[model samples]
Target: MSLPVPPGPQYADKQFYINRGYHQIPKLRLSMDRIVKETVGLRPFRPSGPRIEAEQLGSKTIVHNYGHGGSGWSLSWGTGNMARNLVMATPERKIALLGCGTVGIATARLLQESGCEVTIYTKDVPPNVTSNLATGTWSPASRVCDPAVAKPEFRGVWEDATRYSFRRFQFLLGLNDIACWTDEYSVRNEVPTASEHSAGGEVYEIPGLIPERVRLGKKEHPFAADFVTRRSNLMFNIPSYLHYHLQDFLAFGGKVKIHEIKKLEDIDALPEKVVVNCMGLGAKPIFNDDELIPVSGQLSCLIPQSDIQYKLSTEGANFIARKDGIYLGSNGIVGNWDTTPSKEQTEKVVGILQEVMKNMRG
Candidate 1:
């Protein structure tokens, strides 16, 4: 099926023909029997954007740094640097960092580098934290904030964090797959309208950081859809990525304690006078942040396929090929706090992929 070409110079520039040397890639195996595990994660989405400023809670200084939504993994390094700056302003060198996810570990390492003694207080560790379940990608603006509610200054913050994080991710490439680039293909019957692209409303965007998407011709790819576009973007193998950072933190003398903060008084009882809060969704309860909404997402992983190296996205579902497994996920359900894996959702997601695989053309 031939899709109607978009009528614009923008789309024209993105069009490209495949090279004669190009070869068809191996097809992904999609079946319910292949499913090995299913997990859910809650993205801490604040309509007003991420809180990065320092607030004094009684005698202790609390550096607020949560509510990144789905961009926590993507914007971690940059936001962590921002939180570290706030901690540096205070005279306290002994610091207590809350949560042990990507944000917490990133900030803890940054603080240690600045000569501050850091200890992580969290209820869970790697592979168990919310960030571990992320569909790891460079999506700094995904459900980040509500433009109507977010302050105008947030645009600058988002850009700075995105640019810095992009540069930092580049340095980790080829390092045992801690971070690497993968081709992402978007397949659909029609080109997405501008409004459809930003269904959650405009947040912030930084173009030219990743390669420009190239529209694929009918004979160029094996996808089932009429309209296909591919672009190279950075992806994190979360398991190894977090393990590497956690080891780095420990090697640098950083400490971690398995403690859950249930209230503000629990934070005040800490020995450290200055604290950095990286509690992604956990902030809703401890900080009483009613503005923080939980955007629940689930990922069903199949056994790892070494040949499937790229990512694919269709209408309602997406797939990410990682060293650990093939991750299958869909759009997050906003205001959903339930973390249990939905059998119905899993079957639907797998069914979509199975159909796509069935329709593949060589």
Candidate 2:
């Protein structure tokens, strides 16, 4: 029951075990007693797609770079480069970068490498930022933009960012767990319908950019499902990844100032005439972007297991094994701003995985 190796870069690498048959399935202990913590993150979603263009605000030229939705981490390097190019066109050598989250840090690092002085002004840092709460998967198109409202030209921007980011992430592998590849399994009772596949909404795909999903025979895997498909993709260990980037930025002479920007006037007061906005969801009130909304996502983590190396996705739940814990989450609720952890939601998510592990054939 060995599966046919999918034709892709990952398959070409024998280390991925693309053509290998299954061994004994490792028993996964998933129970409420193992629950460690619950956290929430608000994705900065813009129905019109991410705003990466520049705008004029009084005496300052603000290069807008926020509103990335769930793709902040996946597309960070790409969008960061785009934002850097925008700033390079200006004559200002000293720049003020807003926000200290994933996007902001990436943008600041790029700006620094381009020979520009960067100073970050933010209300919070890692572990307190929204990016820290992310599940850390490479989801470049997750709720990026609404199909009905996005312009025709936006597709090209999305594709370009996705491709550029994918290439950049490859260089960071094997560096203190900043980023690495992980096998993801999608298990289901029946073949997924087209609509079910598109349940996440309009997706902009880049063909051949990642390994193709290969269906595994019943004996090839141990998941309790009628069908199982596997694909290898990159994921970030959010804590260490962010810490590495922040440390790099500081070591490279980048400056950080803890300040809150409440209005346009606050931005105008900055000494740097050129500014890059990586404020994520905070851009809504300060920049007066009505289209920006908060998409709430919650995760419940369990005690980490050394053998749980692969990610899993069922109909309504997802599991990612990070160094911190085994994270469990479901499709988040749109337009929800409450960041409070939900006990009931945690129970539901953990219960689903508990049932799946309990039914494992191995």
lDDT of 2 by residue, 1-362 (tens): 23453334332333333344343356668888898888888989998899999998889999999998878999898899999999999998899999999999999999999999999999999889999998998888878888789999999999989998999899899999889999888878878752243224437778688886787665457777877788888899999999999999999999999999998889988999999999999999998899999989889888999988888888778798888888898556899999999889888888888888888765
lDDT of 1 by residue, 27-108 (tens): 8988889999999999999999888989999999999899998889999999999999999998999999999999999899
Q: Which residue ranges in model 1 land beyond 4 Å of their true spot?
A: 1-23, 194-202
The local lDDT score (0 to 100) that residue 224 gets in candidate 2 is 72
Model 2 CA deviation exceeding 4 Å by range: 1-22, 193-202
For all predicted structures, in order, the TM-scores are 0.92, 0.93
Write down the TM-score for model 2.
0.93
Listed per candidate, the RMSD to the true structure in angstroms reads 3.9, 3.7
The C-alpha lDDT values of all candidates are 0.85, 0.85
